[model samples]
Target: MTLPDLDPDLAKDMQAIEIRIDGENRCLAAGKVAMPEIAKGEVLVRIHAAGVNRPDLMQVAGMYPPPPGASEIPGLELSGEIVATAPNVTQWKIGDRVCALVTGGGYAQYAAVPAAQCLPVPAGLSMTEAASLPETFFTVWHNVFDKAGLKQGETFLVHGGTSGIGTTAIQLAKAFGARVITTASTDEKCQACLDLGADIAINYKTQDFVEQVKTATNGKGADVILDMVAGDYVSRNFKAAAMEGRILIIAFLNGPKAETNFTPLLLKRLTLMGSTLRAQPVANKGAIAGKLRQQVWPLFENGTIKPVIYQTLPMNEAQAALDILRGGAHVGKVVLEVP
Candidate 1:
């Protein structure tokens, strides 16, 4: 079938929401802007939706911005149709529906993504659902699987088990044969995580997660702990981690700096690593995308690993969408549909 001609530059220029800094919530006006050019190994995409993330909220709050060499616009991942490709980008063709992990610039109607970082959208998912995949999925996959080296039959603990990364990790770890344990604040959220294949769902607000994990794991502790809350969870994560276990810290939603006892970590012979998806280099991100496509995409295609969408909002209401994300009430991914 012949594909419709799509000029990404023109599309981006014609459609985009402008966000300007102010004391209160910033303004997101619809206006034209220049679309980025396709660089080496890059493909220009006509974005259909961009996932609203916590980092986007931080950017608007003047705390987080795209790392050096990335676009100033606020977005981390997007799903769209390929419009143009730079030389040597042979893997995709025009009109191919794809989702890509981007450092930034996904908030626009058109964005340039490194060709290698693009993954074919799995069948039976809308662009909005697919848009939610890259940032959270990639982040979880890299930290839980690659960095922490979680294996089948092992026990894994994930903090914030109802958030985007948490939900994705729960499903993926279970599908891959790991025993999942997760912590959430509310009973509903804990039940949701349990339903998503978590073997143990602890309501952190009501119970001590570390003690519960110890009891659940026969006093051995978990094989891995994926932590986003770093303040108090840091020491507890070490305590809950098993001998020779690995702890991967992805985000400090509570706070980055923490004073914690390192004795348990050292005694357990644990490996602690902290990582972020957005600040990673393009090549590294591309490699992760490729690996995820090869290993995890099949699970998604088979309906084993699904994108859990909590809500969808119009791109124009980006601020409200971000506010909801920051509120932490959602159980899964929140997406924003673009024009």
Candidate 2:
């Protein structure tokens, strides 16, 4: 893996967000830390913006923690200029703008990321927009396209139509010729989903998404379902899936456990699967980056896709950004700009 070179001022300290843990209590603090040194096959990014995600909220609540050997910071994705690179890296260089998926350390002003996990920022996207891309885009692409094999003309159903993941999935599925159906909590969010190319937007607050999906499909049901709310939705997903449908679980906002009959597994030939990107090996994430660069980046460059940003705040307001995410009131991504 030949990568371009970058040189950072390692002598200077950098400002970073600290997760000060006291017993079961935790708080965010802005403090100074020594610059991170790049490792083999890694590059250091001078973060311009960091995308806040639900996992960051979960980390604050002690429900999620960074994988071993990862930074204690809570951010999962970032876009910035490459300032330093490891001795052997030759694919990225100083001043190159890129967006990367990281296990942690994205909340900080600087983060060390594997060279292969980085993708050049799309042609017309700002750093904040690019920051919003990595986490949700990678997750949707991997689960929907790579794992579930959602083909053109298939029915793709996703819950949380206003979420970062939901928005990305709707556009990508529709772009790739799939029929997108999504559920949102409000009528406005449902409209937002439709504007993003969803064929049908079900207001789950007032309607039964399962029945709506069935009716919209003429009882054929959805060919693929991306579920973030587990709990009872697990069984309901089985009911909503088409013959030999694939159901992908990416998160458990509604809880993980479900008491459901296993009959659907055999009867409908449905496949239920889930994955978390944080703990994946560098090589695994690198593979996903390559595919995104080749397949999806062009969509951005050609203006076939646009990032949906709900809010952007400065780095010191990290806690406020997380609160907005926790409240689930926003339509798309909330990001922090590093000064």
Per-candidate count of clashing residue pairs (backbone under 3 Å): 0, 6
Candidate 1, residue 40: Cα displacement in angstroms equals 1.1
Residue runs of model 1 more than 4 Å from their true location after superposition = 1-12, 23-28
Model 2: per-residue lDDT, tens digit, 1-339? Answer: 233343344345788888888997898889988777678999889899999999998888888989999998889999999977888889988889999999999988889999999999999999999999999999999899999999999999999999999999999999899999999998999999999889999998899999999999999999999999999999999999999999999999888787889898789998989988889899988999999999999999998889999999999999999889888889989999998
TM-score of 2: 0.96
Q: lDDT for each of the candidates?
A: 0.87, 0.91
lDDT of 1 at 280: 76
**Cα lDDT, model 1, residue 110:** 88
**Predicted candidate 1 versus true structure: per-residue lDDT over 305-325, tens digit per residue:** 889998998888887888888
lDDT of 2 at 239: 94
Worst 10 residues of 2 by lDDT: 1-10
- Candidate 2 backbone collisions, by pair: 3-89, 3-90, 3-91, 4-90, 4-91, 4-92
* TM-score of every candidate: 0.95, 0.96
